[model samples]
Target: MSLRAARDDDMAWLRRHYHQRRAAEFAPLGWPAAALDAFLDQQFALQHQHYTRYYADAQFLIVERDAAPIGRLYLLRRAPEHLLVDIGLDANQRGQGLGAALIAAAQDDAAASGRGLRLHVEHGNDAARRLYQRLGFEHEENLPTHAAMRWRAREPVATD
Candidate 1:
């Protein structure tokens, strides 16, 4: 129910989480177990390097509940907009409104900063797309593999 800066020790969990989150996607390929592990390792390493190099200033956070890690949220604060680089909850943690609550908190933070929040969801992830849309994110662009979405803070209503 809270976010904390990722520690060096968290890297192992992060890597395992990444693999668990992605293993299902490659399952349909019928790759051998060793091949799948190798592929996932390469992909994880590349993604880690890319995020580190490009989002050095971003908040690499571990989402925890009762002092145990349950997910990760990578957010980059920028003028005009804040980038939600990535968010992933443990498979067992999905649903039950946790993801929505976490995203709502991020939205609140973005609104307080007078900025919009943006993220890219894979086209194949219909559930995530629906969740983002329900959270008020609008389609900004369609990339080859992912959809770019943005959520702007609603202006306050005026009273007479």
Candidate 2:
């Protein structure tokens, strides 16, 4: 249960992870294997380009457990706030509190710096939305495809 910097060799695993993430949405379309592969490839490429261009300085990390890659966490540290660009786990790794642990770590980092943590989750992603809410992330804005959410560190209480 640790994270390491992503490397060139991780492209293949990343691609597979991307495909897995979107496969369920497209699965019902009943497209041919070739067509589905092509579509996913193109979509993955586009997403890669978008993240690369916009989050050039972001930390692209590979989440691992027992030396095996199981997830990814992309983060961008900026003034007054930090962005949780993306976080995904292998399908098999879901629902075991791993995501919560990862986000908790990010929260700690932001709190230590006195910065708020922010992220966006797709409207259709109810599970993610619930998790964020449970972690104290409040809805800040609505976008066409996603909802912006933010979490601020709780201030310390003064005692006599």
Candidate 3:
């Protein structure tokens, strides 16, 4: 697996991925499939605009395997901290070790820089929350829609 800068061609795939993940959350509501699709499209557009406006400097990356796009990772590097804006994998790519590896890499980067790594996970996303927790991230704040989490750099143990 590798990451590359997202290109214009990747927007469609990204939007589709966003819709698939979000639609599942809304599935229980029993909205008509067509109506749900339209709603998700609008929401995705709003979210894309929000992220672009607020995180213009963040690295918007496309995660690839064997030259095929499989996911995305958005990261913002800031002094004393790094923000994991978003990470998602295609349905077929889920349940693999890729997400863990990516998070581990981010943790290593944070440790090397003496910085904390942070992210927000939707309150309903138990899987992601559990993963973050297992990887040492602790909930820092509870937002109306999501929970903010952070992982602090570990202190080095002195070998006497």
Candidate 4:
């Protein structure tokens, strides 16, 4: 798998994958299909340009595989540090190490930039929570949905 800057060519795959992924998450929340669709439409409209802004700010990227968009890794620069806004895989790609690879890529970016990385994950998402913990992230605060976490850059070293 490889990561590339998003292009118009990647939109179709992104939309389908994103909707599928979002639907699964909202499903457990008891959201109706219409509500989920509206949320996704709004989210897409609001976020489609994020990579451009982040890239300008030097913060985000889209992860691709075989030329198809597979996931996203975004960082929000907040003065003292940056928060990882999101990192996720297409539904079909989960369990294939893409999620972990995405997080690792984010961590690699943060460490390379000499800044700490932070994120939030649901308390009940044991798999994700454990992955973050394994990568040396620790709790910083509690969010309504989960826990705010941070991983301070230890030393400048490459990890693959």
TM agreement with the true structure for every prediction: 0.96, 0.97, 0.94, 0.73
lDDT of every predicted structure (CA atoms): 0.94, 0.95, 0.91, 0.75
Which one is best on lDDT? 2
| Candidate 1 residue lDDT tens string, 117-155 | 999999989999999999999999999999999999988
Candidate 2: lDDT over CA atoms? Answer: 0.95
Pick by TM-score: 3 or 4, better one: 3
Query: Per-residue error at 144 for model 3, in Å?
Result: 0.8
Which ten-residue region of model 3 has the weakest summed lDDT? 17-26
Clashing pairs in 3: none
Worst 10 residues of 2 by lDDT: 33-42
Residue 40 in candidate 1, Cα distance off native in Å: 0.4
Lowest lDDT block of 10, candidate 4: 51-60
Q: Give the TM-score of candidate 2.
A: 0.97
lDDT of 1 at 115: 91
The lowest-lDDT stretch of 10 consecutive residues in candidate 1 is 96-105
Candidate achieving the largest TM-score: 2
In candidate 1, stretches whose alpha carbon ends up further than 4 angstroms from where it belongs are none
Candidate 2 Cα errors over 4 Å, as ranges: none
Ranking by TM-score: 2, 1, 3, 4
The candidate, 2 or 3, that scores higher on lDDT is 2
Can you write out model 4's per-residue Cα lDDT over 89-140, one digit (the tens) per residue?
8767888877777777777877777888888897788888888998889988
Candidate 4: segments with Cα more than 4 A from true spot: 8-12, 28-36, 43-58, 76-79, 155-160
Candidate 3 RMSD computed on C-alpha atoms after optimal superposition onto the true structure: 1.3
Deviation in angstroms for 1 in model 4? 1.4
